[model samples]
Target: MQGHGYGQPVKQPPHTAWLVLLRVLFVAIGLFSIGFLAWAMMLRLAAVTRRSLDWGLFIAVLAADILSIALLSMEPGDEIRTTSGNFAMFLLLGTLVATIAYYLAADIRHFMQREQAYAAQRTAQAAYAYRGPASPHTPPPMPHTPVPRTPPATPPPQRPAPTHIEQVRAELDELSDYLRKHDGRHDSHESGR
Candidate 1:
């Protein structure tokens, strides 16, 4: 017999790396905007100084970055009409967008760090409040209750003697033997007839 051989390899569609990269970029942009908003809110709540200025700068930088990206994406491009001016414009726009993105990212990182610190402080304060003796509102321990004991049982009362009719029934049973002897012959004659 011929030697056994391995099965043929299954083929798969080609990888769309460029499309995947573009999708990832769009997702990053959306997340960055959300994170920026959250950071701004946290800073305001924590009563940080100059929070308004910080937020204003952040918004301006983000707007500029988005506008530059939009303009660059809308620029005309064809297979045969590429020019040096167009390339330079694209590079400049990309650089400005990247710089603004980096500035916003740095600010967001700083705000997150401060928020985490505030959260930790609040947690520590709660722990202290629970353990402190200044408050007399602590719950009291549960009381233990004793089970009740049952009383001992008493014996039933003695019954009274039987009535006169019950005594007559006992006397009749005692005379049953004499009556049986006297009626034996009569009973046998009646049976024969």
Candidate 2:
């Protein structure tokens, strides 16, 4: 018996402490920062909505990015002489690496899980459902009551066609009437204002 039997405590692989730490970091920093960054952008664009906490995270991330860029731009000959500067550089770089790694792993895992779910659904459907080609048989018969033939459509009663000049005059009259009504109202409204 190489494997543990039923009801017996199975010998599972030991949990990796680093994996747990990575998950915590991923949720705490990766998700939190990304969400806040997006929210802050929306708030900035809208101009009316403001949440200070989200904006704080956005600013912090932006500062970190700027600092990292500066650190990377420095030549190998140049170095941070201060202890705090060195620590900040190391912390920024390490966090960037960890965030990238966690995001990539999480994304790949999500994709794989979705793919597996879709595959399983397809397999289950294929196994249980019979989806052969549609029957070659003719369509079903209509009701026993014979369908009545439709009568030919009659043309609508036609009005006497007006001349082009008359049409234009009619339109002009409508426009003049509209202007007459609105112009007085506009004058009264402006006077009131």
- Give the whole-model CA lDDT for all candidates, comma-separated: 0.45, 0.48
For candidate 1, lDDT tens digit of each residue in 31-68? 56533233232233223335665566545545544554
Q: Could you give the C-alpha RMSD of every candidate to the true structure, in order shown?
A: 35.4, 30.4
TM-score of 2: 0.30
Give, for candidate 2, the lowest lDDT window spanning 10 residues.
Answer: 1-10
For 1-193, candidate 2 gives per-residue lDDT tens digits of 1322223222222244644564455455544553323223322322322345435544665567566556645635467766555755675656555445534454344344444455544543443344333232332232233222444378645886753333544666677789999999999999997
Per-model TM-score, in order, reads: 0.27, 0.30
Best by TM-score: 2
